[model samples]
Target: MGSWERPYWESTVDSGVPRAAQRSGAYRRYLPDAIDGMALAIDGDLSRDVAVVERKLRALNGPGAEGLAGIARFLLRSEAIASSRIEGIAPSAQQVAIAELGQSESVRGVSEQAQLVANNMTIVREATTELVVADKVAVEDIVELHRSLLPNEPRHHELRTVQNWIGTSDWSPIDAAYVPPDPDRVVGLMTDLLRYLNGAAHAPLVQAAIVHAQFETIHPFTDGNGRVGRALIHTVLARRGLTEQAVLPVSLVLATLTDEYITGLDSYRHDAAPGSPPAGMAINAWLRTFVTAAEIAVEQSQQLVSAIEELRERWTERLAEYRMAAGLRAAPRADSAVARVLVHLPEAPVLTATTLARILDVSYPAASAALDELRQAGVLATKSIERGTTAFIAREVLDLVTWSERALASTRFDTRRAEPVRPVPARPQR
Candidate 1:
């Protein structure tokens, strides 16, 4: 009646540690049904934490969070960037945004690091959409997600065929921070994890915490485990119908607190050990960290939404000023460069005249004119990344995106810790 444990032969051909035990505690395969001494019971305090996180998330994607979908897209970019950082791949959010917009091939394949995050972004978004309709997560669903992220890898859509360890600097697990169940046991362990996903054994947040930590423990895939494991967090939210459209940047929050995040996973593995501690006490500690991280993620995301909305308001004022200055105060059509660029700023924080024209459905001349106006109004800044190509930077949006990630990852998790949007520069005195 022990929490599920798997056997790994020590001193085997691929064994990192030189021992002779046919089975070891490090290789225990966890199951969804139950643990020997750890039944997932929600104590009163834990219940409160779960309720708060669920309620916050429910409100974020619910009716209360209006006009946020546009800015929320930016949060998705932030998520991809921050999640990528967790795996030690740091790419500017602007580059990732350009890739996501599908307008620039220059950023594509720039480096393996950037590409991995872009792939994960695609996988997470696609998987979220899939889980919405399926109402449950399946193994095939996971495979497709993995394949999408690491299409060229040997085990792209399949489980790892060899053992994988975390925090190992070399080809040995002896000094590794954590080692998962053996490769042969990945399928069965994943099955049990999915069973828990498809069950009502716990609240959505708690179940998600267990599913994520357990997925990390199983370490099913050889590559992209961290990204996929993070994506599964959203899968749980989508399946439970908690997040209608809001993709909470939970990984961004976790990335800032690396030690706390990893420790939570370690707790998940050790606390559920047979007879180690009472089910509630150990599980409660881990769940507390999970729920708190989630709360911070949502709160910071909300602050981001507000910051974006405020930027939009400035855009509105700037547009009116431009119209009045141009003697078009009574103009019936708001089809000027100011209006067009403002609308596209949220999703496309970085753009060029050629691409801007295509996105705004306007002529090259019009897009150029709009860019000119944006530059004059301090709405967009310009940077030359390559010859004959000027990148129009949405400073407000870009600042908010990158700054929010730093803020979330640091000790400050976006709770009323606001950084005012940079104001538009006034025209020089005549």
Candidate 2:
């Protein structure tokens, strides 16, 4: 809403109009400076918020961070759920977990929304991992990410050639909420974006914010732009060495304030006249929102970490009681069945005796006994029993997951936590 102006060029278009040609105003070939032409000095509050978030993240990844990273799988799953929720696809944590581990029956009907959430889990994991070790983030890496998100779709790995717009069923930008610069500008703007992302032109947090907002404004892909834009948030932070092995579920917070989020993004589309003072106002607004959301994510993440640690201690106490009750003459094996199964729970919460048997490479009775012991310990509860298969729910973990996810949806948890039966596929032993 500030007096921001950006250059524009005239273009011919006719997709939504039944005419030979219609002149349209297209954003001119644009190249934003590292901070989107904004001075960092213009926003001290933003800088301070970024610092606090970074400090909390460092602490979150510190030594007290023990056992938290083990739940990185769950954190990534939470991120996927939230990212997908922003696009109006709400998949339960358990459903997404099942989908991620390549199991389907646990999720009934496998709604397109659930499937998309599952796909996002794959996209986020792949993008974050790739960016963590790469020196630079490439356009192809982004394109591949889009491809992975929208598998089997045309132009999945390519930028849009056809025109697209938001806020209307009709593809006319005339009444669109906002129009991106054009298909021809896709590569050029993307090139500019990658340059900013690669260089140390701004603080890592500021850079990450600019990268995400710019990508959203660019709307490069034919579809999956939102998911891809969100993925870039992780990529930028990872490439900048902000995060190591964890994916913060920041979108969950944004998802909770959908109206404010859209308004912030709309504010981010502001620009200034050519050769005028840099337009930092809108960038500042967006950065504040992003940073606050990230800070909340960190705080909530710490709570969950504590909850998991407490849960683990309770499991240990029960296991110790089991050891005593089992009349073991000496200490139970360090790699005892309960310990091994407990180690496996955070990775795959929903499992049956058979899957547990295979995953732990133990006999069915041994696996079943361990499961029964944990269930008796009140760690897992019976979810379902059908045709020789009995499924157990890691109820406590799901409670925390549902609390966070339902918070994102701005609603109470509707369904009970009764959910997965497979170990997540191993990453080639890496």
Candidate 3:
């Protein structure tokens, strides 16, 4: 049965700590049931719904899709950014791209929030890719993932030694809306969680929902729990082979369904007997919510794929027009730098010539010429990164990224009728 224990909090009166936090008292800490062997009773209708969404996700990652790999990269970034935004680390997609550009070369005009989101993007990519290939996901593996997510925050790199709570007093767990297990219980719970993750006892979507909810319940790390928990959703999908090329961006939909999302998690944390009908219903309700979010993710991501493909077609026509006006007799060879750069623009929308040369394995002059050609053709725009170092951006790609973010932010998936519940960056200026 899910249970709770009253742990006495003898608060230390640290400087600047609130006086209320100094009062010593007993607070309840939840101890969630180990789920490695838990039986989940899902109805047939819900089972079929989950299976249909799984098929859609697979089709989205289907082999031979043009620009599949690049689109996957873009979606991965979108997922990371949305996940970070859910934690209130909102940053413009373009700013995040520039922050990513900063990783390759000197850059300016990027914020710390953008860089943090960029770090999230990197860790999400690494987690989904690396965790899928590991023989077994160890406790250390999950710890390392947290470490990577918070490279600058040393205290958060390890499992939290002190108590942490969500909402209410920042100084103490007093009156907090939710409190996870005691610090001493963390490793054992995490071990059980990892064991479940390494197995395939449930359907992909069901398993992902349980894994994510369990991780959030454990709240293992003092910080970054939300981002790490969301990354695990993608990891579970990839490991189960449901997603091989594209991330579902489920967090994007979840962010818009914040109230339902929290309520679902709350239901999952019920004190009912783990084997009782109430327990089954509790989890099943959460599964329905998660499955719905997954369905929305697939539908919206499909639209993004279509939008990107359409943009690619427009670039091709514009390139043709530019070449015709220049009086060139034939198109640039398929393997030429211009062609290669165009192929990769979806993935790497912002680039420096130096970065492009390294990415495409071409001569510096060749990459520079390709950038010049694409810029002249109106397929790319130039932005000053730093003195003497200009970064080229595919504004349309960045705008699409912004639009996707905004679209996901809205409850309706259309910004025209609904404003975002969270702050979404305005569309980039042309």
lDDT of every predicted structure (CA atoms): 0.66, 0.65, 0.83
TM-score of each: 0.75, 0.75, 0.87
Q: In terms of lDDT, which candidate is stronger, 1 or 3? A: 3
lDDT of 2: 0.65
Task: Score residue 75 of candidate 3 by CA lDDT.
Answer: 42
Tell me the lDDT of model 1 at 207: 77
RMSD of each: 6.4, 7.3, 3.4
Runs off by more than 4 Å, candidate 3: 6-26, 63-91, 106-120, 171-174, 273-277, 329-331, 386-389
| Residue range with the least summed lDDT across 10 consecutive positions in model 3 | 63-72
Highest TM-score: give the candidate number. Answer: 3
Best by lDDT: 3
lDDT of 1 by residue, 1-103 (tens): 2255454425434455334322333343443333312366667977987898898888887532443554555555545554454354466666565555443
Q: What is the lDDT of candidate 3?
A: 0.83
- Worst lDDT window (10 residues) for model 1? 421-430
Clashes of 1: 4
RMSD of 1: 6.4
Q: For candidate 3, write residues 1-430 as lDDT tens digits.
A: 6876788888777667767877778887899989998887898999999989998888977532445455445545645555454455467667888898887788888887788778777776776578889989998989888777666678678888878999988878878889999889899999999999999899998999999999999999988898788889988998998877766779768978999999999888877544544777778888999999999988887887788778888998888889889997437899999988887887788898999999999999999999999999999999998999888988888788778778888999888989878767776676
Ranking the candidates on TM-score from highest down gives 3, 2, 1
